[model samples]
Target: MLLNQLIKELITKMGDDELIIGHRNSEWTGLGPIMEEDIAFSSMAQDKIGHSWALYRILHEELGGEDPDQFAFMRSEKEFKCCHLTEMPIGSYDFSLMRHFLFDHAETVRYNSMLQSSFLPLQQLARKVRGELKYHTLHADAWIIQLCRAGEESYLKMQTALDNCFQLACGIFEAGPDDKLLADEKVYPGEEALYGQWIENIYPVLVKASLNVPERKEPVYGGRYGKHTAYLQPLLNEMGEVFRLNPEATW
Candidate 1:
């Protein structure tokens, strides 16, 4: 495929992931475990959602006229291209922390690769995203290490969170069929290869944190191809109910 076609495909998929995950993270406002963490979570959530809005705007105007919020809140779960990782709930400090840990690492790798992409538009978007990603990773890393070094209970909890979430971790690396074209265009790395790098980047953090990684099945891909986890439906229902109810209502 031509490089522009490939970069266009890849950017669209990447935009979907960023948008949905950002929406999910925004749910953390006022819901975090404590005051400090609450501020932190909300701050990061805002950043992510802002990034999503920017990316989605590109997808909306340039790619097609898909409204950002509607494309986000109205789509069926199966139509959603987001990975399983973002679909999961914000559970305990452990679960949420693990969630952040996994995603931050993946985003770090994902953005860094795109920063050097051959696709001009993609490279520009990636450079903007790169502004916040390193800070996110550093924050997640500190929390993971802190939790791990605290003791057996913290370690166990972190382990459980990691074990449960790692399956979805692979989803970040599972692009749709157009993935190869995107890589060939240098818009982004392919899913399987990017995932290999994610493992290498994440493993040391887990090891230093004193947490044991779990055995997991091979990735069940399809999100980018329109398949979704069970969790996405309810989320969509809620996100869209009001939109549907008041499609023409001015508020």
Candidate 2:
């Protein structure tokens, strides 16, 4: 039962992260810089939302949690455990692109590690999610490399975006008390190990793009425990507005 608590906490954080980022990505639906990017972002947003729904279902069916819709849409700000990186508003194109790159890489590594989890449900889901994330990262990498090497203006923009988002990106690896327990149980490697893997995974891409990886600093934390930015509640309010009116209604 205690192990179930650990698994529930991990998946809840993952689902919330996916839900919030999907909302952010979908904001680019009509605002993308190009038609191709517009379509790609929309597709990726759908994928993230679907991933979140699947995670919530695993929680509900296997871990004794609420229904997926209720669990995702009805949670208050304080109840969410997503990291601060995912909670921030999608800023400029460069910022959003950089975020997509950094966040997806981290997610891919984490899910890849989860392939070995002792938790059977998560292990199975991880296999499927990892397959999807391959395309997500490939898109992110192509765009990042193309833009960063395109010219001085685009290069500078990406560099600045990377600098601005680095700290927040670091926050994605925020550790929890149960991390060690989960690691010991082979639920997944601890966040710190996953964090290291993420760094290695992303470093070469940045290097190839001629973008300087920002130096490590104090990672903005607290979101995992429900401490979030001012931007999150507004996003949540908008996200839940439709559902809040009639949460019990089947859609």
* TM-scores for every candidate against the unseen true structure: 0.89, 0.98
What do the candidate models score in CA lDDT, each in turn? 0.76, 0.93
Please, what are the lDDT tens digits per residue for candidate 2 over residues 1-251?
88889889999999999999999999999999999999999999999999999999999999889999999889889999998888888889999999999999999998999888899988899898787899999999999999988999999999999999999989888899879999999999988999899999999999999999888777889998999999999999999999999988986
Worst 10 residues of 2 by lDDT: 211-220
Regions of model 1 farther than 4 Å from truth:
1-9, 248-251
Best prediction by TM-score: 2
Could you give me the TM-score of model 1 versus the true structure? 0.89
> Alpha carbon lDDT of residue 160, candidate 1?
91
- lDDT measured at residue 166 in model 2 versus the true structure, 0 to 100: 93
Candidate 1: clashing residue pairs, number: 1
